[model samples]
Structure formats: structure tokens, C-alpha cells
Target: MNKNRVRLRCTYHGCELKQTGGIPYLAPYFDPLLQLLNIEVLDSSNHWKLFSKHALVHYGKQFARLGKLKRNDVIELTAQLRKDGSFVYPAHVRLLTNGPRREKIPESRTELIGYVMTQNGLYHLGGKYEYPHYVNQYENWLNKKDSTADQSKAESSSITPNQSYCHHHYGTHGNEKKGEK
Candidate 1:
């Protein structure tokens, strides 16, 4: 019954959440709980931005499926991220975790090219591209798709080098070649 930890079917943040209604209580506890896990805060400068870097990294983005990313979930997900990571916005966290049975949360293709939420407040994560590699990857993927499609077309077109041969590959008729009937 810690006033700090938001619980399932419990009221916190002045929001009355009922059980059957399936409201996510763990949503709000994510940040405060994450802080308790790590030893010290890394960089106080634009905390949320730094956290976004961690959260959107390989693991964080995966767990951003609502309820699935609970306080404990965030604790494990970040295992490294900290300093009041979840203190940003419970709704935003829900956008990431969304959990099971809740509306399935969609992964974003939008580059992390904007401000991100954190414990202290909003912070810029990918000033232009945080790491900038994702954009390259997406571009590479598009290229590969285009190349594969071109190759497929080339292969299909080459099926018959001689158009006449392809169209007149006559089958046997009454044990004799075509026109012998």
C-alpha cells in the first residue's frame, strides 16, 4: 500500500481505476520504480531524452506495448536506464507497453527526431537522429526491396529467351507431335 506505487484496481494520481474495467495501475509506477533499481543518475541534463535513448533502444521499443511494460517490466527493460525514467507520463508509457489484451500498440517508423519525455521533463533524444543509423537501415531496406523486385521481374522475363519457343512448345497429340492428329 505504498502511496508511491500505483497499484492495480487502486486509485492513484487522482484516477479511480477499477479491476473489471482493466485499467492499468502499474502504468504510473514505472518511472519511480525504475529510479529505485539503479544506483545513481547518469546525466541530469534532459533526463527524458536520455531515457528515450534507452527505452527506444533495442529492448525499450520492444516492451513499449503497454501493460506489458509495467514498473517491474521497466525495471527489467532498462536494467540500465534510470533516474526516474518513468516519471514522464503514464499515458506515454502506456503508448509504449500497452500490455496484453489492451489495444495492440504499434511500433513507429517515425525517426526519434524530436523531444522525448523523461523524469525531469521533455528532452531532445535524436537532435537529428539520436544515433542516425536507423534512418540508414530503413534506406537500405528500401533498396533491398527494390532490388529483389527487379530481380524477380528479370528472372520471370528470362524464363523464355526466345518468345516463339516459349509460345510454341507444343505437346504430343495421339503419341505424335502437335499437327499429327
Candidate 2:
């Protein structure tokens, strides 16, 4: 297998399109137009009969990535295998234009679902949310979560033990030190 070479196959479920002997071509890369043709091969419906650029969608049980692929980038398409012997090729590029901005959600919410690239946009079957890019979403979610935790720590550290005690025991109007008579 060529290191730079990649296979382009549409393993979508219930898709009528199939290649003879299931032979897949190992291409160096798949451009926008070729990706569109791949979608046509996978889906038999008219949903993608007319479209502009298609996005290579990576579908995973807990994550996904979707976006415009570069001409030289080594691409790998993957999806969860089904028991019915039909491949769940969620990684196929679909007839999707600039759909929605890809954003990351909590990790707990990402489980048990697969990413889907459709004519409408990218969707998570497990959740109601839509994700355009999977890799970026995971990274952004981690960064956002980390920043939030750091902010919480900073807020907590700003208050000293003495300050807390004084604020809780004494009102703003009675902050003066008590002197024994």
C-alpha cells in the first residue's frame, strides 16, 4: 500500500450503488469534483444530482470531522461497521455547501452517535446538534473546557481566606476592627 495513496469508497448504508467485486481505487488524493462523483456513486437518489462542492465527512462513534479537503492531503474514510454486512460509510463526501459553522460539544454528549454528511449539512445521529468538523470540534471543546476551568480557578484564587471570613462575618457597614473595652 502506498503511504500517500488513499482509497475512496462510499460505504453508506442501504445505498444501491456498488462497484464490481467491491474493488476500490487507491488514489493519491480526491479533489472536489471527484468527491462529488463519489457521492453520486454512493447515493442513487436525486438529492446530490445537482450540487457544487462536497465535503469529506468523517463519521465516528464519538467524534467526526468535515470540511474542504486539500488536493495533497492523505485522506482516510472510515465509519462504524454494521452487523448487516452493509458498511456505514459516513465518511463519504456529500452535496453540501457552506452549511453550518462547525462547533464542539461536551465529550459526554458525543458518545453513541455517528457523524453524517448530507445535502442539508452534517448531523450527529446520537444528538440533535450538527457538527461540520470533527477534529476541530474535539480540539475546541477541550480548549474551551480548559479555559473555563482555569477561569474558575482564577476567580476562586482571587478571594483570600481572610477576605472571605471578613465578608461573611461582618457587613460592609461594620468592617472596623473590634476593640476590647
Best by lDDT: 2
* Superposed Cα deviation of residue 123, candidate 1 (Å): 11
Clashing pairs in 2: 11-89, 64-134, 65-134
The clash tally of candidate 2 reads 3
lDDT of 1 at 96: 27
TM-score of candidate 1 on Cα atoms, chains taken together: 0.22
Report, for every candidate in turn, its global Cα lDDT versus the true structure. Answer: 0.31, 0.34
- Over 100-132, each residue of candidate 1 has an lDDT whose tens digit, in order, gives 564222233322111112212322255543323
TM-score for all models, in order of appearance: 0.22, 0.24
Distance from true location, Cα of 85 in model 2, Å: 20
Clashing residue pair totals per candidate (backbone < 3 A):
14, 3
Range of the 10 consecutive residues with the lowest summed lDDT in candidate 1: 8-17
lDDT (Cα, tens digit) per residue for candidate 2, span 84-139: 43333444433233345544433332221211123223343564433334434545
Model 2 has an lDDT value of 0.34
**Alpha-carbon error at 93 in model 2, in Å?**
37
